[model samples]
Target: MGTPEVSRSPTKSPLTVSTSLTETVDGFHEFKIRSYSLTKGLGVGKFVASETFNVGDYTWAIYFYPDGKSPEDNSSYVSLFIALASEGADVRALFELTLVDQSGNGKHKVHSHFGRALESGPYTLKYRGSMW
Candidate 1:
């Protein structure tokens, strides 16, 4: 008989965060973001980013907070979402988020499956202009 195939998942993955500044309609700044995941054995893993973001010129950065959850008895996953605002604006931006592991490289990408946020809350914002 053929050997049974076994499957495994990533135990820990390296995450990279990237950001860009662009011009948007209504005199707002459009921030383009791209996040990368690097893996040793599987090579370059995954990348996630927003399609387009709208913010005020005074806005300094974007923040992403990840929450941990256990859906099954022992299976656990990480949930994530975004919060955005300017230094002076009293209002902030919040949205539902989801991630998926399409390539199965033990890395997760923002997609239809994987993890999601159940609610929203105030989050501290951090900004990085260049990639290292």
Candidate 2:
């Protein structure tokens, strides 16, 4: 009969780890809607999208729902959204939507992540995600 021998190795004092860095790359695109009256007839839940633009290596677009995105609204109000138009997952981004003033009064209405007083991390948009 024969017996087997066993050996053990000592643990290393320092463990090695690796990490990656990402510097934010910024880009912008502006879309304007002309003939607002013509869009209202497009119907509820229907939207017109802007041309795709690239930022941080991803494609994005703006969607305008002239008759509101929800069918339940009965076309009471208009809606707008920013969407990730390309194939991607867990994409992080910030968004700004503004309604420009046609009049000379300079009273444009703005909805923006940039205007917030508190510091915030970018939003995580999953594959084919849209933000209102």
lDDT of 1: 0.35
What TM-score, computed on C-alpha atoms, does each candidate reach? 0.27, 0.73
The lDDT of each candidate is 0.35, 0.79
Q: Give candidate 1 misplaced runs (Cα > 4 Å).
A: 1-52, 55-76, 92-94, 104-132
Lowest-scoring 10 consecutive residues by lDDT in candidate 2?
Answer: 112-121
lDDT of 2 at 15: 84
Best by TM-score: 2
lDDT of 2: 0.79
Query: Residue 90 in candidate 2 has what lDDT?
Result: 68
Count: clashes, candidate 2: 0
TM-score of 2: 0.73
Give the distance in Å from residue 6's predicted Cα in candidate 2 to where it truly belongs: 30
lDDT tens digits by residue: candidate 2, 10-53: 87889889999977877878888888789987999999889998
